[model samples]
Target chain A: MARVARGDRAAFAEVFRHFAPRVKAYLVKSGAVPALAEDCMQDVMATVWRKAAQFDPARASLAAWIFTIARNRRIDLLRRERRPEAEDLAWGPQAAPEAAEALALQQDAARLARALSDLPEAQRQVIVQAYFGDLSHAQIAARTGLPLGTIKSRTKLALDRLRHAMGRE
Target chain B: MTPRPAPRHHPDAALLMAHAAGTLPEAFSLVVATHVSLCDTCRVELAAHEETGGALLEMMAEGGSGRHEAAMDQDGVLEKVLERAQALPEAAPPAPPAPGTDLPEPLAAYVGGGMDAIPWRRVGGGIRQAVLETGPDASARLLYIPGGRAVPDHGHRGLELTLVLSGAFSDSEDRFGPGDLELATPELEHTPVAEPGAPCICLAATDAPLRFTGLLPRLAQRLMGI
Candidate 1:
């Protein structure tokens, strides 16, 4: 953060190297078209560069802050793109075909892999379906026949548990 | 000093865990921000989650080539971005920010709906409240009350999301500054007081009325406890 605050372009690039692909992959899984996801990724990095001095180590880890930025960008694009309701269902289940590109997310990859692998079948299913499969809580509820809120709550619990377990206590 | 225990209404380990894992919904994300505004335990836990996220990303890169059979430019992006940053004009003059605010760009984009200008309804004594419609759905709306003013002690049967946009508030855990996300489940109970010096302002969303728990709380719930 200090380096970034000092206008360290190299430092900013390192941050991008760490998070951009993962953020992009995340957007793709969340229903963004591959191109749009890439665009958001770039925007998030730009924001990171512009706001690096604002990064508070006492309050936020870099990843959390970056991901929050990515999440916000995702939301902004979703708001701006003006997709049809017919495309909503189409959005889910459309994973990025660039499996080769999924290879780009280099930060924290192994821990997440182990965590994803170790997840209980049900939890894993819910999370994969929700994040990567592009399904919403309501959509997951419909597909799985669970109540909408129940699916949401349970999915949330599963993701948290997996992240915690993989990250350790 | 020893850090305080988290507030009762603050989200538990599970919710932060999911948020770190990137599985929580946008609607739910708002509520989680509210509790995190006041809860450090979850915040630290979130750091742990990020560490894990970093580790996970690294491991996948080295060990999971099976997913990518074709030649690819995943590394190319890293090089490209680095080159671009390296080429940026060095040490340009920094721009001065606007006044009375320290919001991030995204929050700045959302700084409207005239929260400061909205008409607040007095749902109960000493409590000012107002609800506005938003895009996420019927459930996606902005609800606000001046912070530090004790709201009626209440719990929700459904998910409730809060994000502190301005001022500050505190419960059992910690004081929440701007940009904090708080999530409350059906089981959690919350009552927050405004921090000294300013009226606490937050953006909140919920689908159901707050269910006042217990007799005293039930009676005082109208006063709006957080």
Candidate 2:
């Protein structure tokens, strides 16, 4: 990402190439149009090029860095349902950019993935079903035959353990 | 001595799982973003979610379905980008606004900019929303329409939490001022009205969108246009 901060077009291009499809996949899964997904994909990549310098490793990994960007982009787009605001997605005046932290982010992503995969299957399933399957808590309760309180408690504890395992304080 | 009470409720398991799986509604996602901004416990949960998402992406790739993680595209993307860069013009990008001219701290810390400077749209009278903002620290932020108005009565399909930052609002249960945090389960129901003469300014983060009650209220909400 630092390569991005230094106006490295090649690095910026690399960021785009890697994230675009997944961004597209994410948007599509999130119910985005192919066209809208493409558009948001463009926006996400544009941010990478423009705000590459803001990637901070001490605090976040590159995947987390980019995920945050994607999350904000998704939010900006959704808020549009309520109001049509400006297009302030520029390389603007306020940026605590983390462009130099890509390598660290990559390392973090690897560690994080391992930690998540290592979680107890039951706890991991609860997280996956709720998130990937988009199940409501009541629905999860009904589906698993677990009490609502138990499901909730299990999910929270699972997440807590996952976070600790990931080494994020 | 015991540690100070955490300023905000961390995003619980359901919310984190939903976020990791990318199934969280946008409205709720905004609220979650606000919470993660104020709480570290939630951030750790988020880190785990990202990790989970990364592994799923990797597995898909190894199987040859071609999804190289949510934000990282290793094979095809790298090649395409390399080609795109060689043809671009030369010149390093400029630094961000020089020191002393930076955006105000909280706003900068939140969406990385001040409120007045954000691009806002009027959602209704005295109501405007800036949607989603990426914070300096990689958290998410949103610009709520302020200057006093009611928070349309609603409940979540999941737990919802809000952290007051600049103003006040009250639900059937309590009144909340700046720095105060409110946590509501899916079962709670109430109307959120702005305090008279002062618009409620809050930094809200949630795990799902509102499931506004009743057909009449839902219809009325649609009619009110927000």
Candidate 3:
């Protein structure tokens, strides 16, 4: 990222080679078709190259930042495809998180990963569908054959536990 | 239930999860993003969700091969990015607003300037509102109510998200100060009254017109198109 921020072409190439496929796969797993996922991957890489200046290692890990960009871009792209009239407010300039809080989050990725895997199967399944499969609670309820209230409660409980275990208590 | 602290009054985990998933409507996303900009707790939780997403991506055993050979550049995407980066004009980020104005970051772009600059129109009973058009199926607005005043008693026809931006207000739910988001559903009915000491300002979004019980307010609501 330091090299890419400095406009090192070789570094940029390395980043694309490493992250593009994974980003595309993330999108695909989240429900984007292959072609759309590839398109999003390219866009995500382009954003990475452009916003490299804003990447502060103290605020977020490289993977987190890259995936954040990818996830946001996926939402924007999907919204446009579904409702072209609906403009994207998500990508617009907003408050940067407090440096201290971001620093805390930056250190907790590994712990969070472990916590997620430790979640109960039902809780983890709902989260997986919500975060990666792009499924809303109602949709998850439909797909999983659970009641809407049950799905919402599962999600709330899962997040409560994850936030607690991640030490954001 | 005891009134939870401001951090406790966040948007539901379901809403945040939908935001992480990128499936929330733009109007609702605007409210959530603005609330997030103001709330550290939500920011940390959102970051955790993003990290979970990153972990899931990394955990995938089989990385799919390129199926869009034609759409993908035969040469490389890096070249295209570099070229585009060079071609693009430099973005000069706007100067940050001075602290304590109580304006959240996400709402700044829509306001063009600060809160004082907004062209607020009188709705009725010392309440003023500036409706923000955030695409379809929803409506967002900046509402200003004098201290000790109350909005009309009403029930939601659809979802209504009322996020207190400055000062405080108490509804049927509880007291909400700056950065607190109250999700008012159709089944609930309440009147939000500004707390004493200072005028309460809030960013409120609704999917459908509020169902006002009084005939006069309903007529006035029609006149105001709120």
Candidate 4:
């Protein structure tokens, strides 16, 4: 990312080669059509190239930062296609994480991945739908035929379990 | 010695997850991001969510299709990126906040100059507000209430996020100090009074203009452009 920030074409190409397919695949899994995912992937990679200077390693890891860009761009694309009337799709100013927390988080990435798989099936389902499927609480409830309150509690409990699991590490 | 109490108010898990997933609306995301910046606990939680998102991406990469096409168009993608990068503004990121202001880096950039430079307009009842240009459907503002001042009782037409930056305030919910976020929906209405001892400063956003209860504030709402 730093090299891309310095206008290194080679680094930028390398990044696109590495992340484009993964980002598109992620978008497709999140409900975007293959063509739309590819289109959004192109936009996301372009944004990564343009906003490289704004990427703060102290706040987020390279994978996390690129994932955020991809996720947000795909969401914007989907929202615009679905409801163009109210979707502003403007980039908002985001805050930075403290240095210590950022380091701890990066260090614990593997533990976090493991902990997620350890969550109960019900808890994991709601969380996956919320984060990866981009479903709102109500939407998740409707899709799963669960009550809204149940969905909320499941999500909260899933996060608590994650927190405990990560803290134990 | 024990550490200070954690922030009493926070964005819920769904909101935080939505934020990390980058699916939150622009205005709601602003408040969440600002609060996450200031609150270490939320920052860590956000990181975990981001990591989870990254893991999901990896899972998709292993199982989902389109790798062959991605390889084929990698050069085209890089060219488009290069063209886009050339058109980006050459301006640098905003400088860090100067000493003493409670505004976070993101809010400071939005407000431009320093806190003192904020263009506050009186909205009556000893409360002052400086509306910011967040977007058309939603509005962001900085509210300064003198110690003990009270905002009119109100409910939301959509969603309202009020994040305290300094001092404290209380409504029907609870006491809110710095870094506390009070999320009011259409179902809840309460008059928020600034806690005594110091003035209360908040960065607030609303999807729709507040539904002020008192006839006077309601009558003046148009004049105040709230």
- TM of each candidate vs. truth: 0.52, 0.52, 0.80, 0.74
lDDT of 2 by residue, A1-169 (tens): 6677788777766666556666666655445666676567566666666566655564566655566566557655743422111112234465564545545666767766776678888887776566434466677899899998888888887767766866754
* Cα lDDT of model 2 by residue, B160-188, tens digit: 66766555677788876654557777889
Task: Report the lDDT tens digits of candidate 4 across residue range A1-169.
Answer: 7798897889878887777777877787688888787777777887788788887766566777888877767756776511111111123475554678667757777677778888888998887788777666767888899999998899889888887877843
DockQ of each: 0.11, 0.17, 0.31, 0.29
The number of residue pairs in model 4 that clash at the backbone is: 0
CAPRI band for model 4: acceptable
Interface RMSD of each: 9.7, 7.4, 5.1, 6.4
Model 2 ranges off by over 4 Å: A4-50, A70-110, A129-154, A167-169, B1-13, B16-23, B34-162, B166-177, B189-226
Which digits, one per residue and each the tens of the lDDT, describe model 1 over residues B96-192?
A: 4334434322233244323454556665645555554334432433434454576556678777776665676776556666656566668878877
Question: A19-111 in candidate 1: lDDT tens per residue?
Answer: 776777666766788778766777667677766776655434466567656655665676542111000011235443343433332334445
Candidate 4: which stretches are off by over 4 Å? A1-18, A28-36, A46-59, A72-107, A120-122, A142-145, B1-8, B61-102, B185-187, B208-226
What's the true lDDT of residue A50 in model 1?
A: 66
**Ranking of all candidate structures by their lDDT, best first:** 4, 3, 2, 1
